[model samples]
Target: MKNKVTAALIASAMLGCLGTGVYAGSNLQEIKAYLNPGIKFKVDGQPVQLTNSSGAVITPIVYDNNTYLPVRSISNLLGVTVNFDGKSNTVELGEQTEGVSIAKGFDSSYHTKDPKVTIYNGKDYKDVFFDNGSGTRGSSFMLYPEGKYQKLYIQIAAIGEDLKEFTIQDSDTDTVLKKQDVRVEDGLVTIEADISGVKALYVHGDAKSGGSVFIPLTTSYYK
Candidate 1:
């Protein structure tokens, strides 16, 4: 009976020692190394949409209070083309060129002689031609491009402090591409439109006393 009690005590002591080692605090420094949550990204004051390797859209995650963005998406948004070679696992980024300026490259005609490139809101603008005609009559402007362009970036705003309605149309087909009423109180109004296969664009405004101003920003097309 005495030998049996001694064996039982030894077993209980071994179990206590093993339990202490098993329940010991883990190394928090080592654990923190693996905890990378993620960052955020934006383009042109807009949040960038992320896509995974399988071409599925994913949302960005925040890690350590920093925003992370997908490199490919941000690069593309900034006008850099990304190409991947799967066979050799190589990636290529195309060169970015200076975009063509629409205001300098195209010819414009307007009825009002007040429309001229001048300093407005601390920047030079080929300002809009005004139509002060009675009975809410709108004015129009014509632009003739020397070459074809796929995209057109324009900044338009009201002449006064009020909102103004403006429309863009394909002069050849007379198809309305976009129409919107914009106010310039906050900042300069801006838009990016796909003007593919369009030779000429007609900018028109709603029947109003003060005309909406149009400023051509940039044009992009393949060579």
Candidate 2:
């Protein structure tokens, strides 16, 4: 006989079987389930091997003509962090912020001026190179996060003794998101902006003293 079961009930039952002490309560009902080892999982056209936290392979559970997958395994495959809260009997996905380097997504195609990604103080940084001898102004570049990130973190520092000015603007609306001044004496100044729905960003930096300012490559966060 075919039996129907909610995904939440299945998860709660699984956790209880694993000694998590979380049960579905008086409403709990038993359902027939079949382990379908022949089922294959693919992500982005690539085959993915599903494994539990103990390194054991896990297969899909077939019930009532429907397929059920483990929350943890699926979350891991998508680069998302998953956590089980036994106290509240809750499963959380993407609760922690994940950071990706801005250098990887840096694009200069939409820039008004030239900004380059280079090493600064033994670390990778994206900044504008200015020549005081040639009387060159500051530089700007573009970053297309495509509304995939929730926050942008910029760590700015002066190259030498000069103070640096940095500005972040929304490319689509031309609205200023953040503006800050950084100096060598202050060390690294971190600027955080809410880019929850921002599609593109224009980053501008200026240093009148001909010194270059840079933002470390490791400061973009998404949830």
Candidate 3:
């Protein structure tokens, strides 16, 4: 069953369905459950369910090596309308009604110390790289994401040396989302958080050996 599901998604990828990947589970049953017509979602901390007129469920699938959320499902969750014209094979999403900034990575203006935006091998979007200053120096990024979003996916890691400590926080609410006491080892360390009602995100980096941290953030949202 798992193999079947993986094959189906891989096929979709071949057909050029591209978007962010939203994995609820790894098994086929879980994937199916995620697609159930009665599946519930949270938008700005509000619960909402999706329904189809034909009794079919909409699901997110891996396409073009990315997870593509169902247009209908995301639209309903974000309170945006969707229109599809089968004749022209076109899908239209309504303009964003709410003020939200959703993107694959952070822009230069959002960084505090001017982190370099670079691309890694086998990665699609650009990622920010921050170096912990030497001799009692530190760096941080202050990100203000207004409006609603489902998740915040971040890939952070140390360059050569392990990161002694790091912190992720919701600056608007003054709530710390994650604070790592142990070292963030070399290689990619991905973290996903539910940022539904979060107004702002702050990332602080501290290291003993002065290493770099990669932040390839991908924010999910409705239309």
What's the CA RMSD for each of the models? 22.6, 13.7, 13.9
TM-score for all models, in order of appearance? 0.43, 0.47, 0.43
> Could you tell which candidate, 1 or 2, scores higher by lDDT?
2
lDDT per residue for candidate 1 within 1-223, as digits (tens), equals 1232233333333221111112334432421212233444454567765554356664543345543444344333443333344444433333213345554544445322243544356655443433434455565676654223445666655555444557778898898877777665745666655554466888777655443454433322221
Instruction: List the candidate 3 regions with Cα displacement exceeding 4 Å.
Output: 1-127, 181-186, 217-223
lDDT per residue as tens, model 2, 79-168: 444455665666654433347667675655321133344555555444433232323456577777665554677666676655446788
Cα miss at 93, model 2 (Å)? 9.0
**Alpha-carbon RMSD, candidate 1:** 22.6
How high is the CA lDDT of each candidate model? Answer: 0.47, 0.60, 0.48
User: Using alpha carbons, what is the TM-score of model 3?
Assistant: 0.43
Better of 1 and 3 by lDDT: 3
For model 3 the local lDDT of residue 118 reads 50
Candidate 2: list runs displaced more than 4 Å: 1-96, 109-136, 161-164, 219-223
* Predicted structure 3: lDDT: 0.48
lDDT of 3 at 98: 39
TM-score of 1: 0.43
